[model samples]
Target chain A: MAMVLYELCGIDEELRFSPYCWRVRYALAHKGLTAETRPWYFTDKEALAFSGSDKVPVLVDGDQAIADSYEILRYLDRSYPEAPLLGDGMAESRARFFKHYAERSLAPAMLRTIIMDLLNAIHPKDRDYFRETREKRFGRALEEFHSPAKGLAQLDAALEPLRGQLKESDFIDGAAPAAADYLVFGSFMWARVVSSADLVSNADPVYGWLERMLDLHDGLGRSAMRVTDVEGAYR
Target chain B: MAMVLYELCGIDEELRFSPYCWRVRYALAHKGLTAETRPWYFTDKEALAFSGSDKVPVLVDGDQAIADSYEILRYLDRSYPEAPLLGDGMAESRARFFKHYAERSLAPAMLRTIIMDLLNAIHPKDRDYFRETREKRFGRALEEFHSPAKGLAQLDAALEPLRGQLKESDFIDGAAPAAADYLVFGSFMWARVVSSADLVSNADPVYGWLERMLDLHDGLGRSAMRVTDVEGAYR
Candidate 1:
């Protein structure tokens, strides 16, 4: 059976920066499975149309096509029960809380800081579509929303809960990386691959957690094609 | 074995409003256990001296005493082992995340909205102590921090994650109210007992969750003595 993951890539298709896609990638690695990466651009809606969702992170396993990253993770867990991602004892609800927290608070704060870098990293054909759609959603120009200083402040405050948790445990899901850890880790992966922005200070425990996360699953995140690593802080 | 719970109560001893204390009370009910409620006032610090902490919700079970709501919930599961509040498997980490969320994000957002009412609801003798400590912590007077409008706006936005979760499930921890649900329910319980600020609109799913939470454990929350019922929107 062939497993394929439709991921949002950049002008250089090697640069995969979509946080949601990163989530599924981590989940796949966590479950000891492999998927053929199908690079997708923002304007390439036709590629994802078969999945009934106009977004990337569409995963096709055998005959089933899954749209959302979360749904794909769930589908994988249901399909592969070996190394459970959600953990034991109905921890699915807890993982869901982390998803909401990341989407509602962390991602917005991060987007504010790295939107410009993200714009530069996407496919050339996606620049217009990305700007137009994002601007429409925000009801303002990307320049107005892009404030690294203000965003960094908000991001730190938004991460207070995670930072507090990491102080007591190594990972969000504890002992080992699980669904809860992967959900929040997606936010940092977006920033890590696209921008050179110092998301967390070296003194902070979050910085340590980031280093540990990058080292997970045979350094999958660490081996990513980061823009900062290529061009030396071009953003 | 006799179990006695020392809880923080207001001037009217029936009026208990400490969110931390409420967390334990709900956990106790969830475990299908009862403890003799000992109403404690803020000025009554000497009463909690045996717990080695100057806090309410000190649960004395048999010969052991436990402080902190999270610790007490853990203790309940460890001692009782029946009707487990944290749930099975590695759900402990998930419950821990909720603790951090409630303490760091939810509680602060809610305190800004209900601090004034909280002050008024405490024992008259504790007023001066409360004002001094809180003022020092906030670096300002209570009057400056008592903006219900600004606080309400931040609170509604802060509750975005919980609202999203409640839309899909009856409780934070899924169909049944677990440790995660009790962790957050404490914040709303604080507002319910001390003030009638209309925390959530009936139109919101969070409002529905609150009503459901109030009715849980055989109307344990609904039966709580509230200041609003006594003096009709006086705040």
Candidate 2:
């Protein structure tokens, strides 16, 4: 049986915009493994029931089913050890820091900037569920909560640590892209695929790192489908 | 020819509070090495002139003089190669992420919280230099800019990433304290030695990690001299 990865997609299946799913997508590419991507929409809970997770980015390898982006990355690294997503035990722990940092800091900042854009990009069927859940989480309408100016400033501040680190090294993992790189790149992929707003300034070192990340894995991320021209939109 | 570290100190020679210097102190302990710490005051620029850098935490090992906390850690790991401060090249890179994260995010937040406290903690001779430089940096009187409530809130928000990661592991470097642990611990040590304000609540996982960090190296951090009682203040 071939390996399969369930990815969150829009009405256009090629519009795979979930940041968590993008993490797994990039992790697979990093590990030099190819898995058939199965498009799963936000409303498709039944499709993911076998994985015991309501979320997309579920990995089914042979008979084993794995869920959660972090868990899936760990599983891939542990199961395939050849081209490791995380380097070693010590490196893995450090990678977890960046993973958590991105999850807690960067993603939320990005979400606030592009919440409406994300809602529009998803499958029309998932619109009500997304809006209802997200509205409840923020305690306000999605449109009201998102301010591009405020979101962009918050994101720029959040990106400072990453910018500082990237200025000294080519990758977050240094010398090479790894799990930490993908963890952060996933957020940018979400922004690229869903939002037309310029999230990071071209002058920032983080912008340069993003270019390097997009160019990785045979231009896998570079070739990704975006809501607008990726070059013009991101720059 | 012995291992000697020049650490920043207050009027009370024993009251060493420079965050960068504390990083070296803990890092030396992590590597199972001992260095005789020399008290260096902020006004004592002539003392560090030989090292070609006007900085605290200048380490003199045999004939070699190294400056900068991050550089010193790398030097220690490379020179000793026993009980390494950084586990490997990969681990070192990952550690850099935390190092940079703490430096860029955590330290600035902490500095805001304790700037006035830090001024009060420095040597009487260094007071003028300290106030002049710091006030110039902020472009306002220290007292006007600082609000313990606002500072603590900013610090707590900045620490969210570290708090999230620490919930899963014993240390930032994972099972044991390493360069990254010392990198962040140094900032807390700055707050610990200078400020009476509770930067982290006892319920925070970060507070527990701080307890663990203090207990490392036979209570090296715990036994340090503070303007106020460290135990009563931190708790």
Candidate 3:
């Protein structure tokens, strides 16, 4: 195969929900490339060991399997060159500002809102691994810290900086959606796919942006399998 | 005058400490432009009336007067076109991400740590106006909300994303300081000038960035007057 991508999925392999994978997914579409996506569960770290990172979103292109979504995105920009992932002038460094903002702020805020929904959606074989790893990372049991309401509020407050920009521009990257937009879109995709938390109210600009994001790539995000379709997603 | 910037000052006209004004000051230095900075106090709202703004950091270049620090920064880029304040391509929009992060996150976190000190350093004549307006905005008297320790911790948390970036790059913009650097530096300058709270420990990456910022423009920040010298500054 010329290119292949490893993704994390749920009880049903179609329900891909990892935010990091979503970033790479959107980036590939942006670059106009196609890769056969292989759904992998959390229990299969050995499958990803070839890429030197026991994480999903590993892109195998030809002889090289690049691990890490950011690394893959950079590799795409380097190899493709036609469709750029980062910007010119000061965009690369400035974009890192948004990267960290989304990673440190948005992911934490959105994850709390949807962690339980995510746990119930992952494959049965991956449940304990997910729970154990996440609980250890959070230092508490999943049920003990699931505050959907508080999480939604933090997501709102955490989005103020992006909200200010979306008010004036269509995308975070001005008229066009680029890496920065995809960086943040991944989190909202995770929240939307795994839960019914109503993360952002309809009145919010973020909601409108989310809608636009779903509409991008010929409605790729809107077509993703949601918690409602999965058998064990708290139904 | 070719150019003049209206700035908020303290008991001494030289103790310029408004974070917004500091952005414009640093931006001016970045572009290698010279502007006569006029010290304005909080009591004199009428002095800025002609500019259609009740704020500091209003820039008047030749016949045109622009209010708001952001507008002034953009104005510099448009007019000067050399040593651009914002980046090219995706840089402009991406840079705004850092701009708002600094404005909404860093400013608030840093402010709570130094609010009381700020009151003590502002021109004694402007004290009542500053206290009344600020206390009303904050929904309490300054003393009621002065939790310096908690404030410092919050500031520390707020700097996490910046710290992550500074770990790899010398400047947030990479090698050269730009508008984004000034965006965050303004708040730090506010903390350092108006208070002795030691906002960041000496070992912090942010502290090193601050020291480097003070070294810029022939130590412009280092040369500014501080709360230590003023008799009424909580001595």
TM-score of each: 0.95, 0.95, 0.94
Candidate 1 clashing pairs?
Answer: none
- For candidate 2 chain B, the 10 contiguous residues with the lowest summed lDDT are B226-235
Candidates ranked by lDDT? 1, 2, 3
User: What DockQ do the predictions score, one after another?
Assistant: 0.64, 0.73, 0.65
Q: What are the per-model numbers of colliding residue pairs?
A: 0, 0, 0
- Evaluate model 2: give its TM-score: 0.95
Residue B184 in candidate 1, Cα distance off native in Å: 0.4
Model 2, B64-147: lDDT tens digits are: 899999999999988998887777767888888777777888877777778878877877799899888888988988887777
Chain A of model 2 scored by TM-score: 0.95
Clashing pairs in 3: none
Q: Name the runs in model 3 displaced over 4 angstroms.
A: none
**Higher lDDT: candidate 1 or 3?**
1
**Clash pairs, model 2 backbone:** none
Best by DockQ: 2
Error (Å) of candidate 3 at residue A105 is 1.1
Over the stretch A185-207, how does candidate 3's per-residue lDDT look in tens digits? Answer: 88888887888778777898777
> For every candidate, what share of the true interface contacts is present?
0.59, 0.72, 0.64
Residue A75 CA displacement from its true place in model 2, Å: 1.6
